[model samples]
Every structure is written in C-alpha cells, then in structure tokens.
Target: MHCRPCEPRHPDAQRGVALVVALLVFGLSAALLVAMQSEFTLFYQRGSNLFLAEQGHAYLRGAEELATLALVMDHDADQSREQPRDDLGEFWAQQATPYPLDEGGWLVGSLQDLQGRFNLNLLAATVTGTGEDGTDSARFTPAQAFFIRLLQALPELQLDSREAIALTQAIGDWLDPDTITRPFGAEDDFYSGQSPPYRAANRPMASASELRAVANVTPELYRALAPLVTVWPQTPAPLNIHTAALPLLRSINGDGELVPLSEMEAEALFQRQRSEGGFASLDALLEAPAFADKNMEGVRSLLGESSSWFLLTAEVEVADRNMRLYSVLHRDERTVRAVARASGSL
Candidate 1:
C-alpha cells in the first residue's frame, strides 16, 4: 500500500497522559488511607466506651452491696436501743456526702426510709359495709382522710378544694377493686375518655410516682405529695415523727378538728421532740401537747418503733455516661434483703 509511515505521537501529550494516570492512582490511595484511619478511630472509641460502661456497671453493683451491708449493721444497732426506733438520728438517715472513686468519677448514694411517708395503699385496709347498690362498696379510712388533709394543706400543691377531693377520690378508687367511684373520684370510664386513654388500676399502687395518673393530680401536687406519701408494703408504716413533715403530722391530727394545732404548735412540738432522740413511743408523742385530745388509737396503729423498708438511690457517672440505680431494701433483725431493683442509663 502506498503509503506514508504514521507520524509519532506528540511527546508532551505522552507525558501528559502519564502524569494524569499517576495523579488518579495517588488520589485513590489517599482517599483509601483516610477512610481506613477513620474506621480505626471509630472502633477505638467504641471499644473505650464499652469498657467504661462495663466498669461503671460493676461499680454500681458494688455500691448496692455496700448499702445492704450498712442497713444490716444499722438494724442490729437499732435493736440495741431502749426504744428500738429508726429516725433521722440514725446513721442510715444521715445525709449522704459524695465519696470519690479510685478509678474516676464520684459515687454518691443515699438511703431514705420509705416508712417516713404515708402509705396510700392503706386505703384498702378498711372493711366495707353494704352500699346503696348492695355491692361491696369501699369505706373511707383514716389514711384516706389524712391524704385529703395533706392535699388541702399544701398551698404549693396548687390544688383547689375540688381538685384535692377529686384526686384523693381517684386514688382511692384506683386502690379499691370495685368499680364504684366516690362522688369526686374517677373510674375507668373517666380514664377511657382521655386522649391517650388508659384504664384505672384497681389494685395497690406499685410506686409513689403513680399518683401522677390520678385525676386532678397535677404535676405540682404530685411533687409536693411524693415526698410525704408512698404506696409500699400495703400496710401503713409508722411515720418517724422526727423526719415526717410537719404538714403530714398536722394532717393526721385533722386540721378542722375541735382543737387543731397551729403551725407554730406543730413546729414547736417537732423541735422539742427531736431535740435529742425521736419520740420513744406513741404515748410520748401523744404527750407532745399538740395532739392532746386527738384520737390516737388509730394513729397509734400507724406508728412504728423502727423502719423496716428503705429506698436506696445510687448515681454513677463514667466517661461522660451516667447510670442510675434504685433499690428497695427491707431490713429486719434477722437479715437484710433487696426487695426490688431497677436500673437505667441516663
């Protein structure tokens, strides 16, 4: 074929192609290196977090053990006392100061006597009489009356007379197995009408916080009442007059009574009784002058020589992670046992 030989490719063009190929390979290698480094860092961080979390859990368990041991010791010591009473004077009731941990973070825990508050479930203790409907209608007990008085006394609770009565009724209805509701109380029917409908729990409350569900129990009221009332143990715990709120004591004494003690009198009685140790007996409490004519036979039934149940709170923070633990402990002269345990991450 006739021809002319093909011209050689341009030297600059050949060099340009070579340079472009080298740049593409270098770019890919650089991206791959960066991606691998990011993956390695992520894995390292995850491993460190997991290790810290595991360590934090172990520490919380250890904290619970220590608390149980302290309760056992405290119970034995209380038994040695002449009155054998548990009050704010005891070691367990002392304010807990945060203690530093060896590894990192601070461990702070506190023990609260559950019996220091009124038991809401005590409403169920009354033996009912035949009602208008012939059903086993629940009768109002002293505990219910005390709760009503408590709701009425706390202005900070922000409840009107109607709200207080309604909320108290709802609580009683919740604890009573019968569906029959009081004049101011709510039933499953009322709850079902709510937006996010729920049924009334016609049984004993599992916790103190459940009062939030009662009709007309606003957040403010619950906050005020939570510290003064509980639903534990079914039976009423004898409140520590030393640690019990003045309002609770006043409520138990009935504010509308023929001879109601003034706030000053209640406070004065509290100050006098707690000057040394707590009141040794209900007779001693009755002699406080504030409750001179008050009927204490029922009140005495709700008194305690010592507390048997306590709530333990343990808060732990590790590596910016938080863990909270709540344990219910029951202590007797024989042994201390953990009744209920709950844990969660914050």
Candidate 2:
C-alpha cells in the first residue's frame, strides 16, 4: 500500500504519556513508604510494652525479696526478747514507706499476720465419738464452738444459733471425705441440683475464697467474712491472742460460760493489751480480770503467743505500668519463704 510520509507525533502527547507513568510510579512508592512506616511503628510499640512488662515483674520480685529479708530480721529480733510475740506493734506489721526505684517509679509493700485470723481448715477436723449404741455421735469441738461464737459476735453477719450451727455443719460437710449430710448441712446431693451442678470439695480448702461455694455464704457474707479467716499454713495453728481482733478474742470460751465481753469491755481489754505491750503468755491473759469467772477449759488450746504465717502485698509502679503482687509467706526461727504468690488484684 502507498502511504504518505508519517508526521512527527505531538510533543504534548508524548510528554503526557511520560508524565502518567511517572505519576503511577510516584504513587506506588509513596504507598510502600507509608506501609513500611506503620510496620516500624507497631514493632516499636510492641517492644516497648514487652520491656516495661519485664521491668515491672523484676521490680515485683525485688519487692518480694525485700519483704522476706525484713521478716527474717524481725524474727531474729523477737528471738532475743524474753517474750517473743507477733502483734500490730511489731516491725513487720507496720505500714511500709514507698521505696524509690532506679527507673523513676516507686515500690511499696506491707505484711499482715495470717494467724491473726481464724483458720477455716480447723473445721475440717472430725469431732466424732462412739455412743452407747456403737454409732458415731458428732458434736461441736471447742474450735467449732469458738467459730460459732465469732459468727454470732459479728453483728453484721446476724447469724443466730440455728443458722450458725447449720452453716458450720455445712462447711464441715464440704471438707469431710463423706457423702453423709449433717442434720443441718448440705452434701453432693444438695449441690448437684444447682443451676450449674457441682460437688463438695471433700477436702481442705486451698483458699478462703472457696467459702463462696458453701451453703448460706452469700457474696455479702463472704466479703464480711474473708478478712476474718484464712486457709493457710497447710497445718492449722492456734490463733495469736496478741494479734487477733477483739471479736475473735471475745469468742474465746468453753461451754456453759457466761456471755462474752461486750463491745465496751472488749475495747478496754484491747487498750490494756496494747498499753502493756501485749500479753506475755496465755496464762497472763487468763489472769486478767476479764476471765475471772469465765470458763476457759477449751480456750487455752485455741490461743497462741506467736505467729508463723503472714501475707505480703507488694506494689510496683514503673513509668505508666503498675503491678501488684500478693504472697503468702511463712517465717520460722531459721528463715522465711514464700509459699504462694499471685499477680494483679487478688
């Protein structure tokens, strides 16, 4: 085919084609740069968070160590004294001042005497004896009686004789390795009928929080009761008369004893104890006018002068990160150790 000489393409059209290609390349490069920037930012934040978490944990562990050392020192000091006892006045029981950290934060810790509270595991103990018919007869032991008295004394709980007895028996049933229910207690048969069925532990409780699962222990009751009881020491120990609250103190007595000290009288006794640097021995406590006429045959065995179990709560703050540690520590004449530990609010 015959064709005319081709005309040169317009410079503007050629320039436009080149410009489009440049623009596409520019857009793609910009998008790629933005994506890379976002990825870098995310990695930076993740690493920063991880570092802070590790630092916070280290500080908490350090706090635990410091608490253990303080307890040991306190034990050494008490050994030198003629009357060794743990009380609110002891060094370990005092509120701790916040310690400054190297990384611009503070650490705080405090110790509470676990023995100051009633040991719930004591109820798990069997108090049965053989009757004339050769059948096992169950009765409230001295410890159980003291628990009943404590429940009655707590005006907030408002548990009367019948209800208190039922609750105590229920707790016992939960702990004992048996399916037989007490006259006023609940067993697997009772629990299996609940909305989400469950059974009795049939063993000692690992934590006081387990009380919530028992019969008649409402949330309100648990809140009021948790502070006054403990499930620790693996083996139960006597309540420290020097450290026990007035309510627990008033609960100490045997059967056929008169009504316990009124609030006013108990307060007087508490004040006297504090002023006299706590009781030197259980006998000294009994000799006080408070027990002149009160029957105390079962009381002596339930009282002690010293404590071995304590709770250490440690808090650490590093920059914007805050953490808390709860540790159950056991102290002895030789050393101190943490038996249980948890992080966050307990």
Candidate 3:
C-alpha cells in the first residue's frame, strides 16, 4: 500500500512556477526603476529652476549697479553745470538699450524720478490752526491741496472736484495716526467690516500700490493714479517739475481756486522745460503767461528742479527664466545708493 511518495514534479510545472516568479520580480524591478527615475527627474527640474533663478537675480544685480553708475555719472555731469537738475533729456532718463550678455540673455534697465509724481504720504500732513468757524479742525496741507488738484486735472480719471477731495481725505485717513476719520474718509472702523476684516495702515504707505487697500479705490482708478503718484519720501518731498507728467504740471495753482493749467498751456511748459533743460528757478516758472494771474505760492513750494528719490526698473533674462527687479535709489551729494528693492513688480 506504499504510495508513489517519490513522484517528482513535471519539468513543465516547475518551469511554469519559475517563469511566474521571474515575471513578478521583473515587474516589481521595472516599477521601482520608474519611480526612482521620476523622483530624479523632479529633483533635476527643481535644481535647474533654482540655478536659473539665482543666475537671473545675479544679472539683475549687475543691472542695478549699472543704473547706480549711470546716476552717479549724471550727478557728476550736473555738478559742472551752473544749475544742477534732473530732466528727461539727461542720459540716465533715456530708455536703456538691452545689453547682450556674454552668455545667452539680455539686460534692460531705466531710471525714473519718483519726485515727478505726487507723494501720497503728504496727505497725512495737516494744519490744525483754525477753520472758517474758528473751531479746531484738520485742514488740508498745501501738498494735499496740490494732490486734489492733480486728481481733478487727470481727465482720464474723470473725477470731479468733490470726488477728488473725498479720495484725498480717504488716503489721509489711511495714513494719519489717529482713528478719527475725515468727513469723507474711512478709518479702521470702516475697514473692520470688510469681508476679510483688515484695518488701516495708519502710517506711510510702502508703495503706491497700497492705494488699492484704501476705500473707494478701484482697479481702474489705481492704475490711472499709480503712475502719477508715489509713496516714497514719506516726509513731504517736492515734485520735480522737469520730470513731472503733464497732469501734475497742470495741477499747479494757488489755494483760492483749483485752476489747473490747460492742456495747451501745460504742453507749452512741458516743451519749454525739455528744450531749456528745465526752468532755471521757481521765479522763471512763474513767469509763464498761464501763471501770471494765478497765485504761485503753494505750487512754487511743491515744485523743484532736483530729485532725491528715483526708481530703477531692471529686467534680466537667462536660461529662459525672466526676472524683473525694482529698486528705490536715493541720490545724495556724495553718491547714489539703493534703499529698497522688489522682484517681479514694484
């Protein structure tokens, strides 16, 4: 009754089991190899992106240095002249030709006078001496008045006198330290009810873009005003008449009436400033026929021929990676230096 205890398995059966094991092992190894390759590819891409970003930033820094050098050279050239002023005719004001780098890529940079635009920080400055009713009230500073006029003068904004005043006061509230709101302005009390619930800055704005956070500021309005105003020189910097846009130029006037310069009149002054390398003095500017009857006191104080704050926009492209750098440059009698910088946009 002894069974065939020693019956060996068939060769085909053994081969079939061996083939199944081999297939399983091969499939697992192939899957593992694919995963490893995917991970390696991801890391390689990350490293390549990081390298390109670093390289692009380095080129941007070089471009900033070039801008600084150009500014210094401009200062030197101006020093030799009897009246030193920054104007569009200067070399630094011209659009820079993109510099072809030794490696693939190019660099472009240009300097802009921030003083050519109205300083929004000036809205915070107020005179509290007296009001028409002899009661204590915050009165608009000369600079604020100038800003109102500038807003009204901008035909593209299509803002009326009252709307301009309200916007100006709203900006002032955003900057003033106290929570007391202006008659037409908003404070933390107003902003706290917003969807996200944010408070006012209650200090100088870091960038003109901050206007977007203020009340009643639309994207279209901000876009229109951003180019015509600045937030730097938070301590009431004069507007550089030579580089000021036509809208700002037209906004100059006395306090009695908001009589902005006409387009033809502003264009005349603009052309004259460009051809004459800027007005020799404030008195010379006042001599314009448009200003003959208008009181020039307030506008005169707000206007200047020189600028201390300038913006440098530098763009660099390397390895298909593009970088745009914005630097705030401060120029002194001694040298020019970068005060603040941002990547992508101002």
Candidate 4:
C-alpha cells in the first residue's frame, strides 16, 4: 500500500497553540511587575523610617543647645541679683513640664541640681572603722553620715541603725584606697565571691549604680537610695532645699541622729521652699525653727541658693521614632557649658 502524504496542519490549531504561549508569557510578565512594585514600596518605607530617625536625632541636639542657652541666660539673670538662688520660679526649673514643639515632636527637659544629693564619692576623704582599731579604717564624712541618716528615715526599707551603719562602712570600703575590709564592708574578696566576680572600686565610684557593689546594699535599699544620693559632684555638698526630696531633707542633720524634723516640720519646710521660693541665704534658712540646733554648721557652705552643676534630659518623639538626650551642664557665674552628653533611641 502506498503511504499517503501527511495532511497539512489546520490553521485554527496553529493559532490556538500560539494563543496558549502568549497567555503564559503575559501572566509571567504581570507577576514580575507586581513583585518589583512590592520591593520598591518596601525600600521606600525603610528609607523614610531612616530619614525620620535622623531628623529626630537632629531635633534632640537642638533641644540640648536650647537648654544650654536657657541655663546661661539664667546665670546672667542671677548675676544682677544681690544673691542668685535658683528656685522653682526660675525659667529652667519651670520648664520641667513637657511642651509641644513647633515641629511634629514634643520636647521636655529638667534641671537636676547635682549638689542636692549626698555625694557618695566623698567616702574617699575619710580614713577608721570600729572593728579595725589598729589598722587604718575609713571614718565617716558628713556625706556618709547624711546617707546613714537618710537610710534610717526610710523605715519602709526596714534598714535599722546597725544595718545603716554597715551600709555606710561598706560604701566607704568600696571607695577607700586601701584593700582592707571593714567588719561589714566588702572589699575585692567579697566581690570576687559573687557569681560574676569583680573588684572593689578602691576609688571614687563612677556612677551611683556602683552602690550595688557595696555589701548589704540590696536592690530594695538601692531603689530607695538611688534618688537621694549621688556619686557625682566629686566633693561633698549640702542638700538643696529647692530640689531635695523629703528623704534627703530629713537627713539634713550633721550629727546623723534620725533627722530632727517631724513629718509636719519637714512638710512645713517643703511648703515654704516650694511656695515662697528657696532661701536666698543660709542665714535665711537657719532662721527656721527646725534648724535651731547647730549640727548643720559644718555643711553650711554646701547649702546654697544656686547650683553649679545640673543634669538636663530631653526626650523627642517623631513619627515612630523616639530619641532621648542627656546633658550634664556646669554653670558658673558667667556661663554654662556641657560637661557630658549621651543620646539613645526609645
């Protein structure tokens, strides 16, 4: 039988195959376009977030400069007065409340008098402990005594007189130059015994948080003490009546006998200082009946109407970004300068 020639393919069938291939190509192109658009959108959002964050940081820096300007102006204004005493009525102190920024974010800053808190670093100045009669031990300075009295005032912390004394001794040991340990205080040995061992500072504490390194300074006690005491100011200073908390004010005595003032008496002092502005002079402060006793004599020079050092904190929020800036300012009779600055995101 002769093979018949193959029949020619129909035109309709060829057209159908071409249509199928065209549909596949179109579908693939559409999918690729959608993916590219999604990637572009994601990249744009990331860049926008980065821009806003940088803008927030810039705003924070501006806020810091404004704070410095305000402080310098405050000093200039104080120069005109017979006695320059910073008080709640002053512009810097009054600015503690948050204010809306002309920009999209808000700004808030406050001045914290460094000298208002007991200086923990002063323990380095003293050198005798009850346990070490022969060896050189640290004698409590007025600042340490103030801390002890402050501790006694916090009955809620349940720290008795003995514990308070021990805490003081421990702090002294941590700060003292010698490695000799007191009866209650911890030296390098005590710290080395912990889970993560460290050594005694054997020097001035860099931060108030270092108090946790001292013996008998539990988290509870530390929490109670953090706001009232400080390792800054280097030298000892007296409590600033304008800015002192009740616990610190109650520890105003030099003799360290559970602060002499009753609740009403303390409250009265707070009321006058808060309402009538702080005392212009130590003599004016001494006029109060609560200060009838002269136990506070040694600390008079520290009790001042004006502060030399201050901490300013500024927080700014822009869109989804939050920024916080911390500035430590040193203010003198003439000008204000930033001693330290730190910033971070929230």
Give the winner by TM-score: 3
- lDDT (C-alpha) at residue 128 in model 2: 60
Residues 1-346 of candidate 4: C-alpha lDDT, one tens digit per residue: 9999999999999999999999999999999999999999999999998898788778777877887888888888887888667777788777566767676668777777776677787656553344243322124556666666778877578566677878878888888899988657778888899878888889888788898777777888888888777765666555566777777667666443433356676777778777777755567766678777665664564466567778888888887467898777777666778877788888
**Which 10-residue span in candidate 1 carries the lowest summed lDDT?**
130-139
List the candidate 3 regions with Cα displacement exceeding 4 Å.
1-5, 130-138
- The window of 10 residues in a row where model 4 has the poorest summed lDDT is 129-138
Better of 3 and 4 by TM-score: 3
- Cα lDDT for residue 251, model 2? 74
Highest lDDT model number: 3
The better-scoring model by TM-score among 1 and 2 is 2
- What TM-score does structure 2 among the candidates reach? 0.88
What's the C-alpha lDDT at position 249 in model 3?
A: 79
lDDT of each: 0.73, 0.81, 0.83, 0.73
- Candidate 3 on 24-57: residue-level lDDT in tens? 9999999999999999999999999888888888
User: What TM-score against the true fold does each predicted structure earn?
Assistant: 0.85, 0.88, 0.93, 0.80
**What clash pairs does model 4 have?**
128-137, 128-138, 128-139
The all-Cα superposition gives candidate 4 an RMSD in Å to the true structure of: 4.1
lDDT of 3 at 100: 89
